[model samples]
Every structure is written in structure tokens, then in C-alpha cells.
Target: MRLLLKKKSVVLAVLLLVGGLYLINHSDFLMAGLSRSPEIHPSELTWQGQLLVSKESWVDRGQYLPLNVSYQLLAGAPATEQRYLSIGISSVNRKKGSYLISTLQSIFSMSSSEERSSMVVVVLLADFDTGWRMATLKDIKTTFALELEQGQLVVIHVPLEFYPPITGLKRNYNDAPERVTFRSKQNLDYAFLIHYCAGLGQYYLQLEDDISCAKNFLSSIRNRVAEQEKQKVTWATLEFSVLGYIGKLYKSGHLPLLARFLFLFYQEMPCDWLLTHFKLVMTQKATILFKPSLFQHMGTFSSFQGRHNKLKDKDFDDGFYTNPVAEVFSNISTYQKNFPNLAWDAGEAFFWGLSPVKGSYLTVVFKEPAVVTWIFVETGSGTKDLLQSAQVELGHDVVTTGKDKSCKDFQSVGAIENGKFEMQEVDKKYSSASKCLRILVTATQKHWVIIRKIRVTTKQSAPRQE
Candidate 1:
């Protein structure tokens, strides 16, 4: 009886052990599901169909005037030692010249008076006739009377008769088939204007006649400029709008080269296409592009007949789903702390550093794993250890530490501009399951590196696994 009882006890112990092991393994699988957050795949936040571009040009520019003699100075902005200049080019043949009014109006409405006051709004008159241009100038003088008198409004007339004729521009109309619609001449027009206003101020803004702007665009420009200086990266241009060549900003110093480049390639490609290619000609890649596009393309009418303006019907919505700035970055590796803290948002000051030992970086952590589309890094102008080179890496399934931790594991951002900030748009969106973005300051030499602003734009979505 004792033997039987002992055997029963042994059997009971074995059964209990097996039951405990089973529960342990199964519970862990169930718990994992409960803890996991819903994954919003990057694929889900994408566009379908052919991508679109906005190409608006004055179709009648070729038949009319000489750019040189025609570049008549209608009005000049009051000179007050302004640091920047916003240029708006108005051509002939468009309706009402309402773009001139709207561009200036938007500037006044969104930016501070001081900023508006400092900007020189040069409206180029490339109309079909002198009468039309004169009439339009009269309308502008009357409408922007205050600005005109204050030296904030400038109107220039570049009539066909006096301006230089389209000469020396080599072309492959087949490249930009739109050349059939006089798109090549339109390209030349932009080249001339950009060259014309090349060194008018410390900075030149490429403002179009038929584009609308976001609120605080001026502030955005100013902030970006300041950040670039603070961040200490050598940059070339600050691109405001992603649609075509509407709101492109350039360093006055680089204008001559850029303008000349446009001159050489005017006939080969559209102005918008020229912008990206032009960057490659010089920097091997395009400069920083502002996300959530500060300026939107609103023109529905195509400047080139038969080619309708398709910016309105983009296959996907390209607005920024994430804010350019965040309150604080989570799981930062290390940062330089001093007066004037790092600016994570667009308007803030910047993050400055000096003698950062090897492997120092500014990290941006998100609440959940996300797909990052862009990272805008603006460096400040300081002499010590300026960020000469850098690399950006995305982390997935990581906590404070991340996988793929080497600079080689990341991508190299192109050359930094001298005494300015550089913006790098990811060619392809990066998905991070760990929800962290690591910007490794992999290279810096001499002087302090000032990162005035580091903006990480992300979509709060990720792909989940079984």
C-alpha cells in the first residue's frame, strides 16, 4: 500500500511540473500580443499613381522682349541695411497680375512688418506689350502705394524689344518635350531673372507670381537662416517649396554660379528639373527641402498651353503629417549644454557643441515606431568644431541603445555649406520599429558645431510583425 501511495505521489508531481511549463510558455506569447501597439505601416501612408510636378512659365516670353533692356527698374525698396531680399518675378501674358498682389499681400499678412519692410519685392514685367505692363505697373503702384513709397515694393519691366534676345542657349527640345510649347524660353526667363536678382541682397528668394504662401513663411526663412549659422554647416540653398521652382532661396554669394548654370542648361530641362540637376552639378545632390511645404502651388492654369498645371491633382497628398520640431528628443546619446539651448523646433535657437569626443550625436525619439521622411539640420556660425560632415541612421527594435549602430550602417549627408545650414531629404522614407532617430555627428573639424535646429519629420505609423 505504501509503494502504491508513493507511486501516486510521484505521478502527481510530474503532472504539476508539466502543467507549470506549459502555462509559462503560452502566457509569454499571449502577453506579447497585449503589450504590442498597433502598427501603422509606412506603406499605408503613401501615395498611389504617377507623381506630379508644377511647371508654370510665361508661354509668350519668347515672342516679346529683350531681357537686358527690358529689365526696367519700376520701384526700389527703401534701403535700411536689410539682411535679406525676397524677389518676385512677374511676367507678361498672365491674367490681372494678381499673383503680384497676392504674393506681396501674403508676405505682409504672414510676416512681421519689420521683415516685410526689409524685403525687396521686385516684380518683373514680362508682358506682351508696354501698354499692358504700364497699366499693370499703375495698378501695382496704386495697390501697394504704401509699400512703394516705403521702398518695399519694386517693379521692373523687361520688355522684349530692349532685353537680350534668346541667344547661345543650346537645346534638346526632346528632353523637355514641353519645349514645343515654348517651355525652353520660359526656362531662359527664369535663368535671366535669377541672374538679374543674383546679388541684390544677402539672400535672394525665388518667388513666383502665381503661388500662395503659408503663415510665418518669412519667420521660417529667418529662423532657418539663423539656425544654419548657429549649427555651423556649410550649405548652398534653402528650398522652401517642393513643388517646382516656386519658393527657392539661394545664398547671394552662390547666385552668380547658379544663375550661370541655369543659363547653360535652360534649354535642356524645365526650371524645376534644373533645380535638382543643378544641385548635382555642384553638390552632387539637392540641398535641404522644407517639409509640410511652406509655400503651396495654387495655379490651376498652365502657362504652357496644352500642358495643364497638374500640381492641383497630385496622386498623393504631400503635406507634412508630423511637426518639424518636437518638444524634446528621447534617448539622446549626448549633447552640448550651454547658453542658448538646442532648437528642436523650427523657431528655437539651436544646439551648440565644442570638442565633442568621438561618437556624439543628437537623438530624436518618438513615442512609437514611425517612418521618418525628412530631417532638417541647420548649423550655426561658430568657429569651434563646426559640423564638417555627418551621418543619419534609423533605429528599429531598439531601446536607449540601437541596432545598426555604426556610421557605416547609416547614410552620409552631403557637404556642409560654408557659414550656413544644410538640409537633407531622405531619398526613401526610413522605418524604425524602435521609434528612434539617430543623427551621428560622425565628422566635425575645428571650431564648435552649432546645431541651431534639428527637425525630424515623421509619420506615426509602422509595420507590425506576427
Candidate 2:
């Protein structure tokens, strides 16, 4: 009797152990079904297709979750027909402030009518907060009714099932668990966004939600694409801003592979670093960055919680300056006939002046009273021929008193230290319109001066955003 009881107990223990192993192996599948909303049918998932997993360690079938994801169209739907360009922007709740509306305004207002017709702007609400998503979509729909009706704007959101286990991810580079989770989720977000926008247009432009666009930026991108075609260069990414993943453009045809790559290694690195690897794997060896960047970062708060950053792209051409018609004059003698006007004009030859004594000045007098906004002056070609000591001043109430037709009354705005000076908002001190901009030599200098650039912007020339 005792031997028989012992056999039965052993059999029961073995069965329990086997059952527990099976449940552990299939926990994700069982939990996924139980936790999913009843409204979501199997067919409603975003990507129905299955990706064949490789035996590689990075993509081990048992380690990574399945690629089947789900999403919802909260607002505008995608156009049926293809477009010339597709602009992808991803947004999340920031701790400090929201810049999504301003970013949308910038893109829509900066793009020309024809440019708008040629492209589609897709906004992905990457945050999972249901209330926040609804509120954001409401704001977007209300603000861009015409654009939504015209099929130029779209809003998409990935359902909760879109992500894998984001928390407690293997910390690479000794990153904190929170940072790892943030970047890992970011990678997944970008992957989902890239996959969604893959077939929407001929090219895909990745942009952040806290950026301002330059005027006619779409036209500039088209021109850059045309130039690439003319050169017959096989490129992966055409960068319009140096900031992280703000203005990166890629061929639409290659987006699928790029998306898959990101999804596979979502936990390993950030989205931008993954992009670099993707570019290299595609046989494009170098980053193709364009000058006069078309986007600028305007967010003071980062999307990552509890972090603050103030990032700006120096190359961004904000289109504040029309370089309005003006006459240039200088007291320093000219070199090789490189007149002072040459520095202000849109040309290669700058204002090359000989050695200057104290009180020598280079002046630019506008044809009308101008509300100056921004000024940037570069006074050196190389280590030599630099304006060693100078100060920039705003001249008001001008009378054509000098022989070169310069202004007389001046107020010091800023000084030229280290051969360069840049200032914004010249109207802060003097609300009245200014007559001229003058760069005066503070002290005598033996080295000749090369006014490499003199970029000026005014309020009247800047485009007003509605």
C-alpha cells in the first residue's frame, strides 16, 4: 500500500511541473489575449504579416516578441494616391510645454501652395495616454481642417499592443533603466511610424514635433533631390538639420527594410544610432548633409521625462532676412575692388578692406526705415585678415550727411568679439525704425579685414504666419 501511494504522488508532482513550464513558455500569448480590449478583433491589428525570424543572436525567435502590431487612425486618413514627399513627425507628452501646434503651423505656413499639394504631412501621436491622444487629435483636427480635408495632413496612433516589453530592458552603455526604456520605446515608435509611411510617397522625411521649418522648405528639399538625381549619387539619407532625427530624408522604397532593422534591434540603441547603422548597411558610406538647414529645434523641454535641453541648429535659415535693397560704405580702403557692397550682396567676393585705424567704420544704409530683427557679421577669412577690434551699432534718424551717404546718429547694440557678432531683436532698445547698420573699428589693427558675411534681417521682410 505504501509503494503504490508513493508512485501516485510522484506522477502528480511531474504533471504539475510540466503544466507550469508550458504556461511560462506561452505566457505572452495567453496574457496578450486576456489583456486586449474586446473591441479589437484579430483583423484590426496594424500589421497582419509575419516576419521570418533569423537564427542570429540579436533576433532570436524566443527572445524578441512577434512583430505583429496594432494601431488606430485617430484623425485624418492617408491619401490613396502617392505623393512626392511624406513628412513624418512623432509627438509625445512633454513635461514642460507642447510645441506640436507651432511645429505644424511652421510646416504648413512655410510650405508654398504647390509644395503643400505635392507632399503629405503625417503626425504620429506616440504617447499611449488615451486622454492626451484625444486632446491632441482634437487640437490638430480643429486647427487644420482645410489640410485634413485636402488629404495633406494625417494623424496616426499605435495601440498599446504595438510595443514589446519596454521596461527593464538590457541596459546598454550602462544607461539607467528609465533611459533604456525611453530610448527603446522611441526606437519602436520610429519603427512603427516608418513602416506606416513607407508607401505613402516617393520619399520620407523624418522630423520631430518641436521644430520650425524654413520658408519654402519643401521646395528646397525638392531642389536637393533634383541635385542628387543630377549627380547620380546613391544616397541613403539627405540631412536638412544637424539635430538628432529632425530633418532626415530617406527614399520611400528603402523604408520597409529600415523599419524592420529598427524593430529587430529596438532595445539595443537609440533611433538615431540605428539610423546610422541602417545607412551603412545599405552601402551608403557617408552622411549627405545639405547646407542652409531647413529645420530648427525649438523645444526647450525634451520628450524624455525629467530632462531639459535647449538645442538649436546654426545652419537653419529662418527666412527672417530678405537682404532688402541697401547701399554699403566703408572708410577702410578697398582691396582688389572688393567693395563694401560686395559683403552685403549675395556673392562670393566679400568686403576686403586694408589695414584700419581707429574710428574707421563700415556702414550699410537701407533705402527705407527698417525694423531690424537679426544681424550676423563675420569679419575673417582665415587666421589672418580679421577685424581684431570692432563694435556693431544701429544708426537712427539718418541724414545723408557723409560723402558715402552714411547715417550720423548711432547707438551701440553689440560688440564684435573674436571676429564675429550675432544679435537678434535690434528693436528692443529703439522701438522706432532704424536707418542703417554700422560696424565701427574700436581700435587700430595692423591686419587687413575681410568682411566674410553680413547677414541682416528685418521685420517688414519676414513672412507672417497665420
lDDT of each: 0.54, 0.78
Provide the RMSD of all predictions against the true structure, rounded to 1 decimal.
32.4, 9.2
Distance from true location, Cα of 103 in model 1, Å: 2.7
TM-score of 1: 0.49
Worst 10 residues of 1 by lDDT: 46-55
Candidate 2: regions farther than 4 A off: 1-66, 320-466
Task: State the displacement of the C-alpha of residue 236, model 2, in Å, after optimal TM-score superposition.
Answer: 1.5
Q: Residue 116 lDDT in model 1?
A: 76
What ranges in model 1 sit over 4 Å off? 1-70, 77-82, 95-98, 161-181, 284-286, 312-466
lDDT of 1 by residue, 1-466 (tens): 9999999999999999999999998895545423433322232221111101111112122322222212445555435444477575756565322345544555555566777766777666655465666666665665568778877776664435332335444455544344522555666666656655544567788867665556567767778788777976657667777666777787766665665566666566677777777677656443776665677554445555523464732321223212433224422223445332244543444665564444666565555655554455556665543566655566544333343222223434443454333232232333333344555655545556666655443434554352
Q: Write down the TM-score of every candidate.
A: 0.49, 0.61
Clashing pairs in 2: none
